[model samples]
Target: MMKVFDEYRALSDDTLKPDQPKAKRFIEAMRKFLDKKENWTFWLPYILTLELCVKCGTCGEACPVYTASGRKEIYHPVYRSEMLRRIWKRYFTLSGKIFRGLAGAKDVTEDDINALAEAVWRCTVCRRCAMVCPLAIDNGLITREIRKIFDAIGIAPDELKENGTRAQIQYGNATKTPTEAFKDTLEFIKEDIEDMKGVSVEIPVDKKGVDYLVINNAGDYIAFMETVMGIVEIMNYVNADWTLNTPDTGVNDVVNYGLFYSDAELVAVAKAQLETIRKLKPKVVVIGECGHAYDSFILYKKLYKEMYGEEMPFKLTHIVALIDRWIREGKLKVDKNKNPEPVTFHDSCKWGRCAGVYEEPRRVLKAVCKDFREMYPNREMNYCCGGGSGFAIMFKDEFLKFRMETYGRIKAEQIKATGASVVATMCANCKGQFREIIKYFNLPVRYAGVSELVANALVYK
Candidate 1:
């Protein structure tokens, strides 16, 4: 039983010290804010809304962490919420007065804060639990709000806080890759495109009047340069008018993880992307092979409008959708003979499930690969890679093992059963996660984006 909470329990040792001035100030502010709110306004509303939660454990069953971690209590959806519920009641609820035990009220110590921070950060907020919940309670959203409270109290996980601040303040990305590195990467991709296709392909930077404004993260350049080169090759082959924003090209700030909790910072970073797109005024904004970036563009567009008082004029399209459209429009030509071996696709959690971009990438894969195989559970129902929610960067070590044993295990088994030589996906994060897992397990399979495979198979004029 104790081992079940091992990952979660270890966090308590870093509990906030009561003597810290910042901790004391933040805690006092929270207590006073909760008290000022009409008991029914925010506090009771949240409690009453959450109390209807039947604890059917549907969410527990849906969480990737719970599934991968073997149904541990610490990974359970209700566990953290239940713990917070007790603390809320002990401090604020009147029912906690006469029947404290019945209401499950408990005082929130510094240890409680630390434990809750760890528990909440562990979740990816993928919202898979909401799909399984009969009441649509959205435990993922609750987890995010819990994270918000932690952020307010200055007790967020060190990695999350540091990365979030770096994203906002430093190089405008969590990884903080230098602008010089970004431009050098572009130059490298151009050289690769020339070498592969026998043509010098130009990927324009910050060019106005281009039909599409493409924003990609530095990850695309460093780890998945093939995909970046692929996009350029396809664009050149198709004669599509597009430009990359070198100055503000990194819109992949969605992994900041803070956005899942902090609305203000989320809006600020989202506005930065929009501002870049607005400067170009392209017909469409093509989000490169990153999923969460598209989430920010598609999901938070309205939020941006509310803040800025006008809707963005550009259309947000994922790169997969763009590639699929190119294939359909007869712009990019693929010769399946180049990739004669069998291949399977891994659906990205954000792109496939959250953003409903399942079919476009599959269509692109079907065109690129001679044989395309499906996993046991396909589309929206597919399991997470355990690294989907920024775990690829944050808890790389633990997430690598977890992904191989769980999501990657399933994917590898499916690929082996199909006798596929490669696994292809559209999302950059998926590419990294799958590639690492395949390497660690010594699986004889190469992983790439659908665009990269298509680019490799392209029949150039």
Candidate 2:
């Protein structure tokens, strides 16, 4: 029995034992998830991980959840990966059929399936384990594969499945904001910009033939409009032609929750966004400060090929890269003295590690802030914000407590060590996680998107 870490609430399904019929369905689902080629992008790599992982336990040392939970065995990356590996060997491998116990294989049961579902969610799928594994096995891939199986069997969190991917696919945004309401929100942001800076800027929406079509996570309009304003400010200052897609275009939001779970849903959302992009005909599609959105756009080229049997029609890039270019090209004037507070950058896992966007945001920060500090083990090695893989939006009270008190503790300590008054990160999820961490840990620090700081430091000359 894997012990639950002290004080953290066990997941609701931790003790569940599915009835016979449900158990049969789960076993069938797992088998299909394992064998389906459509379900995976890197099928050979996954097989390599399943067959080659040596159980060295080096991955656990690099896992933030394991380290933050005081090295809880349950939260270890290999602990979760081992469960899936054992199940795979039990059902699919030749030697396991003959030498079950000796081969470390066991009979699949409702109890086992339930436990597997519970184990997969406990991880944030940051892929830090892959970074440390000597064999370069991606434990995050296993976790996501299990999640894909669970989602097929209707065993996923509603926050991610129902409100996240489902809502995004059906409603053009996860929030399900009406088209008119989205327009009203943009108008409100425009008014706020005028009020703050005494400038009247017309935000281009649904405009055709623009050089850039910028898509942010729809949630930013609700929770982080200031960050949206920041991007808009810089775009205007640089005289760059850009437009935000209206909901009518069916690609209003940058969020793609499928990146966290089902490849089917991932492709579904990507296809919808691609159709919209095809219609818009923008020179570039800019993903705003959401890590998964950045990750999703990165997959567009391959996904587009898989779907259309043709090349991706539009170019995609993250907003931070554009900000860095603008600053370096002298397109936007910035006064670093405008931001005097001690600031530190929290490298989001997908944006920095997975996307290989390490130096761009750091360079942008240095150009905009006078007292920028670096977190130890920064860039690709930086710890997760306890909010990757769509956990930031999940809000079960017990899980939230675990997210902050246990999973987020190590990141909180990292932030404290920087001694910065403001934490600058490019991912919205990281900012959301920091919101909880600041309150739970009672650290005297606030968080902002890097674009928000750049907007603050912009000098209109």
Q: For each candidate in turn, give its C-alpha RMSD to the true structure in angstroms.
A: 4.0, 2.4
TM-score of each: 0.87, 0.96
- lDDT by residue (56-147, candidate 2, tens digit) is 88998898888877887878887887787777777788888788879977787666676677778778888888888999999998888888
Maximum-lDDT candidate: 2
Q: Best by TM-score, which number?
A: 2
Per residue, candidate 1 scores C-alpha lDDT tens digits across 368-437 of: 8888888756677776665565555554324446556655665566667767778887776677777777
Global lDDT scores for all candidate models: 0.68, 0.83
The TM-score obtained by model 1 is: 0.87
Worst 10 residues of 1 by lDDT: 1-10
Q: Model 2 scores what on Cα lDDT?
A: 0.83
Candidate 2 residue-pair clash tally: 0
